[model samples]
Target: MSKSDNLNLPIYDNRGKPLELAYHVTYTLRLKNGYILALKPGEHIVRMPNLLATDVKRRA
Candidate 1:
Protein backbone atom coordinates (compact mmCIF):
# COMPACT_ATOMS: atom_id res chain seq x y z
CA MET A 1 0.00 0.00 0.00
CA SER A 2 1.03 3.62 -0.52
CA LYS A 3 2.37 5.72 2.36
CA SER A 4 -0.71 7.90 2.61
CA ASP A 5 -2.97 4.87 2.54
CA ASN A 6 -0.92 3.17 5.25
CA LEU A 7 -1.30 6.00 7.77
CA ASN A 8 -2.88 4.64 10.96
CA LEU A 9 -2.34 6.93 13.93
CA PRO A 10 -4.33 8.44 16.75
CA ILE A 11 -5.15 12.10 16.07
CA TYR A 12 -6.62 13.92 19.04
CA ASP A 13 -7.90 17.43 19.49
CA ASN A 14 -7.04 20.08 22.08
CA ARG A 15 -9.50 18.58 24.54
CA GLY A 16 -7.70 15.22 24.33
CA LYS A 17 -10.57 13.96 22.25
CA PRO A 18 -9.67 11.30 19.74
CA LEU A 19 -9.80 12.55 16.19
CA GLU A 20 -8.21 9.72 14.25
CA LEU A 21 -6.92 6.94 16.41
CA ALA A 22 -4.98 4.28 14.54
CA TYR A 23 -1.47 3.06 13.64
CA HIS A 24 1.07 4.64 11.30
CA VAL A 25 4.74 5.60 10.85
CA THR A 26 6.15 9.14 11.21
CA TYR A 27 9.45 10.88 10.44
CA THR A 28 10.64 14.47 10.72
CA LEU A 29 13.04 15.94 8.20
CA ARG A 30 14.25 19.37 7.23
CA LEU A 31 13.36 20.41 3.75
CA LYS A 32 15.48 22.57 1.44
CA ASN A 33 12.75 25.18 1.48
CA GLY A 34 13.28 25.90 5.17
CA TYR A 35 10.16 23.95 6.01
CA ILE A 36 9.71 21.03 8.37
CA LEU A 37 8.35 17.79 7.06
CA ALA A 38 6.70 15.48 9.52
CA LEU A 39 5.88 11.96 8.49
CA LYS A 40 3.46 10.38 10.92
CA PRO A 41 4.84 7.24 12.51
CA GLY A 42 3.03 3.97 13.07
CA GLU A 43 0.69 3.87 16.07
CA HIS A 44 1.54 7.51 16.71
CA ILE A 45 -0.56 10.21 18.30
CA VAL A 46 -1.41 13.27 16.18
CA ARG A 47 -3.38 15.97 17.91
CA MET A 48 -4.97 18.96 16.26
CA PRO A 49 -6.81 22.24 17.02
CA ASN A 50 -5.12 23.56 20.15
CA LEU A 51 -1.69 22.00 19.72
CA LEU A 52 -0.36 23.09 23.10
CA ALA A 53 0.45 19.56 24.21
CA THR A 54 1.76 18.67 20.81
CA ASP A 55 4.15 21.61 20.85
CA VAL A 56 5.44 20.52 24.23
CA LYS A 57 6.35 17.13 22.86
CA ARG A 58 8.25 18.76 20.00
CA ARG A 59 10.37 20.75 22.43
CA ALA A 60 11.40 17.55 24.17
Candidate 2:
Protein backbone atom coordinates (compact mmCIF):
# COMPACT_ATOMS: atom_id res chain seq x y z
CA MET A 1 0.00 0.00 0.00
CA SER A 2 1.04 3.56 -0.55
CA LYS A 3 2.21 5.83 2.26
CA SER A 4 -0.83 8.00 1.65
CA ASP A 5 -3.04 5.10 2.67
CA ASN A 6 -1.37 4.65 6.04
CA LEU A 7 -3.42 5.33 9.14
CA ASN A 8 -1.96 7.47 11.90
CA LEU A 9 -3.80 6.28 14.97
CA PRO A 10 -3.12 8.32 18.05
CA ILE A 11 -1.93 6.65 21.21
CA TYR A 12 -4.19 7.21 24.17
CA ASP A 13 -3.52 7.10 27.87
CA ASN A 14 -5.46 5.13 30.45
CA ARG A 15 -7.74 8.13 30.91
CA GLY A 16 -8.59 8.04 27.18
CA LYS A 17 -6.67 11.17 26.41
CA PRO A 18 -4.47 11.09 23.34
CA LEU A 19 -0.77 11.41 24.06
CA GLU A 20 0.74 14.45 22.46
CA LEU A 21 3.94 12.81 21.21
CA ALA A 22 2.82 9.25 20.67
CA TYR A 23 1.24 7.90 17.50
CA HIS A 24 0.99 4.60 15.73
CA VAL A 25 1.39 4.67 12.01
CA THR A 26 0.00 1.61 10.31
CA TYR A 27 0.49 0.59 6.72
CA THR A 28 -2.87 -0.65 5.52
CA LEU A 29 -3.88 -3.03 2.77
CA ARG A 30 -7.47 -3.64 1.76
CA LEU A 31 -8.32 -7.24 0.96
CA LYS A 32 -10.75 -8.55 -1.60
CA ASN A 33 -13.00 -9.74 1.22
CA GLY A 34 -13.07 -6.18 2.62
CA TYR A 35 -10.86 -6.75 5.63
CA ILE A 36 -8.19 -4.20 6.28
CA LEU A 37 -4.73 -5.46 7.23
CA ALA A 38 -2.76 -2.96 9.29
CA LEU A 39 0.94 -3.33 9.82
CA LYS A 40 3.03 -1.32 12.23
CA PRO A 41 6.73 -1.41 11.66
CA GLY A 42 8.89 -2.64 14.53
CA GLU A 43 9.25 -5.38 17.16
CA HIS A 44 5.74 -4.75 18.44
CA ILE A 45 4.44 -6.63 15.40
CA VAL A 46 4.08 -9.76 17.51
CA ARG A 47 2.01 -8.13 20.25
CA MET A 48 0.14 -5.39 18.42
CA PRO A 49 -2.07 -7.75 16.42
CA ASN A 50 -3.77 -9.17 19.48
CA LEU A 51 -4.31 -5.68 20.86
CA LEU A 52 -5.81 -4.56 17.58
CA ALA A 53 -8.06 -7.62 17.47
CA THR A 54 -9.40 -6.90 20.95
CA ASP A 55 -9.98 -3.27 20.06
CA VAL A 56 -11.89 -4.33 16.94
CA LYS A 57 -14.03 -6.67 18.99
CA ARG A 58 -14.93 -3.91 21.41
CA ARG A 59 -15.81 -1.53 18.61
CA ALA A 60 -17.81 -4.13 16.73
Pick the TM-score winner. 2
What TM-scores do the predictions have?
0.22, 0.26
lDDT of 1 by residue, 6-60 (tens): 5333444323443443356344332222223344444333433444344565448
Error of 2 at 45 (Å): 20
Superposed model 1: Cα runs more than 4 Å off = 1-5, 20-60
Model 2: pairs clashing at backbone N, Cα or C within 3 Å? none
User: What is the C-alpha local distance difference test score of each model?
Assistant: 0.39, 0.37
Clashes (backbone N, CA, C under 3 Å), per candidate, total: 14, 0
What TM-score, to 2 decimals, does candidate 2 have?
0.26
Predicted candidate 2 versus true structure: per-residue lDDT over 30-53, tens digit per residue = 221123334334412222233334
Error (Å) of candidate 2 at residue 5 is 1.8
* Error in Å for residue 59 of model 1: 25
